[model samples]
Target: MNTLSIVIPALNEASNLPAVMGTVPVAELAAAGWRTEVVVVDNASTDDTAAVAHALGARVVHQPERGYGNAYLAGFDVATGDVIATGDADCTYPFDALPDLLRTLVDQDVEFMTTDRLHRTNRRAMKASHFVANHALSALSRTLFRNGLRDSQSGMWIFRRYIWDGLDVRSAGMAFSQEIKNAATTAGYRFMEVPIEYRTRGGEVKLNALPDGMANLRQLFNHRFRRQGGRGEAGIPAQKQRSERYEAV
Candidate 1:
């Protein structure tokens, strides 16, 4: 049976995890031939993040190295599935969209899919400054990497595990979001974007808008100018590489 690993990076989402976990359509996912496994990365939280996830029947991995990228990289290292889906633990990204997101990946024959929250249902979902910063980062990505992405800062993404073999993911901070997309697009991975509804998160917002924005901007320029010699690829032919073997961490 095909496995689908849902990776959720949580800081202190004890209250919010139930809502997110409850929305996962297990029956539908099973009917569609995916055995669901939810992996929650506890990113060094003071609250009961790990306990809540364990009580809810999720495999919790404690990541002492605290960063958005570090949490996700830890999750990605341990996810045992053909396809991996990532989202925020704060409940900003919709859990109900997983079914469509998976279907779109199969139908379109794409390796990577990310949500576009530009046409969001909740107007107050994102601050005006954040919205502007996101757009600026997206524009920078398009200019540097030439991928027509509308939302570069989106935390939600789904893709085949093997795609990591051809792409380099080196960021250990918030800039990792942009780095993954840039590497994927630069390596010519098939990409698609799904329009998703954005909502206000239940937990305390972790994003430092100005600092994170500046870091992402610098990452964009650096990636465009840098020449990665041999570490870019997985050091093997794409067809020769094992589909299940992932070495991102």
Candidate 2:
């Protein structure tokens, strides 16, 4: 049976880890013909994040460098699954929806599947300013990259592990999410976005909205022009793929 590595990058999220980890439907995924391995990347948290993850039966990989992308890169290196899935350690993303998303990924023959939290995001889950910023960034990304991504900053993504080898994503911070999606689409891989419920987080929010948003804007422009020479080498197979919303059952 193929394995699915659920890699979660956590930074001082000890209070939120349990709720997040508990919702991963390991048995359901197993029943769906995929064995699940939860890999938690401890991003140099001062709290008991590593211990909490371990106690919850997660394999903890310690990443001394503290960045969102650094933690994910570290977790990806240690993940032992053919298929890799990502979600935040904070309880905002729905881990319980993975089995359904995985089924959609395979059935649709998608190489990279990212979730859209912006479509159905509640006011309680995201601030109005942050929501506006997300929309502006996503719009710019679509215009620059010519890909139909609704949420450029969504952290939840599921994709074939081999695709990572071909991607040229280099962002070490919050901009990594947008960069990875852009890389995958630019590489002519099949990509899709599914809608998922965005919940209010359990711990203190870590995003420095203004600075991170500005950095993401810069990264999008930089990445777009950097790959200009090799833009259509493979052609965009993802564009030919559909971008329908996934209605959860």
Candidate 3:
């Protein structure tokens, strides 16, 4: 039986964590041979994010840095599981659909699996500007990395823990979403994507479309042209240096 750690990166998501935690089907997962642990990585939130998460049966990992990438990196370092699952704490990504996704990952034995948020039926869940940017980024990623993934900005993913060892992830912002995929693809990891519903966020929207899009674009180009020869060197851990900056909460 393999362990699964579902890591949710939250920043001031005090109100949203309860619903996210409540809806997770922990018992069902355990019955299906996965000892699931929900980890809420609080990214220096001023609100009661950590306290709320702790009360809700989630182990809260505190990350002082304030980036989507930073929060997840911290969570990954602390996760004690064979497989790592990632979703947003804002409730935009569905927690109910995780069982099927996990089944696919296990059945197919893929190294990397992500969801396609573009198939979402809710028209108002995503903003028009954000949708456009997501498509542009997806196209750019496919062209640059040849990964053939539809959603470059989708936050939901499940991957083998050791797959991180082969990746040289450096993005500490929104760009981390695309950078992880690029690194995984470059390392020839098996990849797959399934459709998942994208809902409206529970709390406030945190994405800055223009700046984040520009940063993702920069990440794509940098990864394409820059020489990444020694980062994921044999025996070295994934994002080793980056993980040192964070302290346990």
TM-score of 2: 0.90
**TM-scores for every candidate against the unseen true structure:** 0.91, 0.90, 0.94
- TM-score between model 3 and native: 0.94
How far is 215's C-alpha from truth in model 1 (Å)?
A: 0.7
What tens digits encode model 2's per-residue C-alpha lDDT throughout 79-197?
77999999999898899999899999999999999989887546568888998899899999999989999889999999998888677667789999999999999889999998999
Q: Per-residue CA lDDT of candidate 1, range 110-182, in tens?
A: 9998878876565589888888778888987888888888888888899998886667676778998888877
Give the CA lDDT, 0 to 100, for residue 248 in model 3.
Answer: 52
lDDT of 1: 0.82
In the order shown, the candidates' Cα RMSDs to the true structure are: 4.0, 7.8, 1.7
Lowest lDDT 10-mer window, candidate 2? 240-249
Which candidate comes out best when scored by TM-score?
Answer: 3
Which candidate would rank higher by TM-score, 2 or 3? 3
True-vs-predicted CA distance for residue 222, candidate 2, Å: 0.7
Q: Candidate 3 on 1-249: residue-level lDDT in tens? A: 779999999999999988989879998888888898889998999999999999998988988989999888899988888999999999888888878889899889899998888754755788888887888899999999887898988898899998886677888999989888878877899999888889888878898877888898988999899986555446454465445665654
